[model samples]
Target: MKLKTLVGTFALAALPASMSFAWADAAPEMTDAERAQAKQIYFERCAGCHGVLRKGATGKNLEPHWTKTLQDGNKVEGGTLKLGTNRLERIIAYGTDGGMVNYDDILSEKEINLMARYIQQTPDAPPEFSLKDMRDSWKLIVPKDKRPTRQMNKINLQNVFAVTLRDAGKLALIDGDTHKIWKVLDTGYAVHISRLSASGRYVYTVGRDGLTTIIDMWFEEPTTVASVRLGSDARSVDVSKFKGYEDKYLIGGTYWPPQYSIMDGETLEPIKIVSTRGQTVDGEYHPEPRVASIVASMTKPEWVVNVKETGQILLVDYTDLKNLKTTTIESAKFLHDGGWDGSKRYFMVAANASNKVAAVDTKTGKLAALVDTAKIPHPGRGANFIHPQYGPVWATGHLGDAVVSLISTPSEEAKYAKYKGNNWKVVQELKMPGAGNLFVKTHPKSTHFWADAPMNPEREVAESVYVFDMGDLDKAPVQLNVAKDSGLPETTAVRRAVQPEYNLAGDEVWISLWGGKTDQSAIVIYDDKTLKLKKVITDPAVVTPTGKFNVFNTMHDVY
Candidate 1:
């Protein structure tokens, strides 16, 4: 509410220094229920007049307002029309044209008011990128010096910022640098997957209920700036390569009535909706490529989508959103995971829950190598959960338990600059052998890393976490000797832990342990180098909170 008065000045300052424009008005925020109701209004009364997808058959893209300037330049082409905030509101409140019926009397003023604000507001901004940009390359090693901020929170600098989908449809912001919580904002939906805008100004979350909410993390005071309704039953969202394109157009999939929708992130306007060949549940996908998981190549900035059910990896030219091309890979049981390995040269896939991590050359889409990562029998947890992480090497989790099936790639270039060149090797398999999920975080400098092998919950117990190094072939799993139980004695090794992430500073590793399958969970932090315990905090709100439990909430992943 206070933002309204200050937003005008903020907008003025945000204008590109090169451009000169008149004063603009600040938009209002919509209530959660109002946003939910707007979709119903869209389908019932509005779809016929404006194109259902909102790309101006009669109306505009609805998201991005259709009047936003093209990425190529500051000009508006194709006779695209623009509407002022008041004008757009009046049109919705009253009516337009002969066929478009007036909603003034039919719809309540409250409903009409929300749609007005929705049409006028720009898409939410992405979270700011804190890393310094180096043209060639960068590494994410842990930083030295351990200290808390003025707020008594740890200050970490190298951790990857991650958004966890709380069971209640809210999103919490955790500072990866300090292992301290920055803020937690209600997303207004049951969030599943999320992606930040390229500019790092907005954080977007797409939920299972088919709602996408964008938060303005760029501000010191994070807020859910906008909420857009995507339709029902949406799953995952991949950010389009085009940065700041109407607040990050997301390519997402749905469960029932199987289909994919490319939506304007800012306005939640459906740009193009396509039907898939098979329902995602059946795994009987057809050639109709609906987006399963979309991500842009860090190297070339091309948009890549993994058609999960079909095992299809579709690479689309970034220049033209329509210029899509596809190449199918062997069934990995999941299209949601796997992609060009760290090098961005070969496509990698987890083969049918097997320990075999397969790779294919992207150019030919043919199997190049089936790197056997330890001869362990495949644990049947359904292929859906057997996902891999992208690093200089490919790391996969086995459903069976504690064995982290790792596949190494040669770090040799004709001329490797910073790190030493090495040969292709099966650096040693560190075995903690058990029935737990595997989460891996790579160290910035060395080939050393850590994996969260859950043991139990509460009291005091000895749980083993592997801090092994995978150097050149001759070397085996060199466990980075850490002072076991050196710090945070309250953290018993018996509890189950979920996602363990490194702080931006790479100095500490934060682990979120399930409160013994109860309401008592703990957030533990480990010194990256010494493996000494830094802190252990408890949380009873492992899932949701009423009021008292809110204070106990620690994060799962660092931002």
Candidate 2:
């Protein structure tokens, strides 16, 4: 049977008599086909924030059971009073004020009703994916020997943008120089991140559906050279970046089955799989400690694998995958995406639920520090810059709070010797207009820091971006409404401006104006210095564009 068919097949049989409340009778019973369709919709749309099991992280838990602890500290449980079928349907169709996007524009009325019922039923326990299964799913479309040995096109390879065409399961390679779509190739469903190989030749993308694809940039028109299924669901993927291990091994982290897979970097052949299910930082067993993000260390021949719920950061030595040596360091929980500091020695990541940012020293393979920050820090490879007062610092925006946090970082430069005391501390918090900020970014060559609030509840703030001047810290950021700047006709659905990325030269900043599949989406480029609209690249081919990764910038780990 297909995965979707298997998804909720056990729901009816496994549900207890008490769970089948009279309220559930109001919600229509779903046929096998309806169940499959609803399951797929949830996987593509809701699984990222809310887990496959529907036990939430960033979003609220959608489990069939609800346990409420009253002020007296007594467990009040009879049935799911908080989430009846009627209430679930309303929430699914209209969404909530807490950063959840409404499905009115994205899904049809019937589809929304289907999802409402699907979540109220028992969530299926997806089958575990073994290394053998991954090997069976691996496909080498173009062998390494068959790929080109040299650049075959005149296009500026460094400026190429691997734009994630979300909802369409494809990636568009756009020329930053000419603002043209060079080629569009198939990728996984809702590709989360596009990681570049150290040599800047291979582009690796891992989607929410756990499909990892490797595209060869050396091809005449960038082609999908290799592909593999990491698991039922995946988020992060990266190639080994150390000097001797450039593109030697690839690591993909999955959300379901709670594991990560290692493969040959060139061919994407599965080598080993490691389960992340273990005790959380609090020493309690967590069955679904999903592997959130994986980063290749520059100082050591290891990969920094962060297990989300467990708050355990594993430094897996790539030199010996056979008898794999892993050093696990305990830190704060809800660990999410992160990047290297200015020195590239300290890897800083957000322990968002803990409201802290955990810094790991790769050199020592130990927990350096866990600095407290604003609520729900969602830093997307956070911005690194030299502070006028605090010396070198890292920046992160929040999802639950309205502020961009600046944490001082240690640096070796003699010029920054005076601010050594400020290292690993939250130096400042720039107030934002609203909450629900997902990504913050900056460039070494650029004079500004860029942040996006696409997750903001309000349409005005959600459709705009803020730019901060590095020279003047006291001044407020200039908010640019990118949705209006795109020059596209207004649509009823909110067009979110997200993932501000810089060109290879850092002269241009591209913002993806993500909209519904039917809406006209655009890639808005702005002059980094002038902060003026340069070009709005809108093509019918660029549908539901979200994350844009520049080839050179991503390869070098440029913020």
Residue 300 of model 2 has an lDDT of: 89
How much lDDT does candidate 1 score? 0.43
Give the per-residue lDDT digits (tens) of candidate 1, residues 1-559.
1122222212111224565333234545666676557665664455322323443222223544232222332422333223444445555654432113234534566677667666544532222211121111121111112211122323231232444434445665655544455666665344655566654545667665556666554444555655554444454665554433433565656532245556555544455555555533345534333244455544343455555445445554444457544444444433434444445555554442234555655444455666655422221111111112212445554433345654555333533333222213333344643423334555344334655443211112114455654443223333321213323233322334544455544566666543222334446667767766787644333342111111111111111
TM-score of each model, in listed order:
0.55, 0.92
Query: Which pairs, if any, clash in model 2?
Result: none
Q: Give the Å shift of residue 15 in candidate 2.
A: 23
Which numbered prediction scores highest in lDDT against the true structure? 2
lDDT of 2 by residue, 1-559 (tens): 1121222212122244453333333334789998999898988888777788877666666676631111222222533233445556566655554556567667888887788778777787899999999999999999989999898989888899999999899999999889999999999998999999887888899988899999998878888989999999999998998888889999999999899899999999999999999898899988888889799998889999998888999999999899999999999888888989999999999987778999999988899999999878999899899988888999999987889999999888899989989989999998888777899999999899999998775778889999988899779999999999999999978899999999999999999999988998999999999999999999888899999999998887799
Off by over 4 Å in 2: 1-28, 67-81
Using alpha carbons, what is the TM-score of model 1?
0.55
Looking at model 1, residue 180 earns an lDDT score of: 57
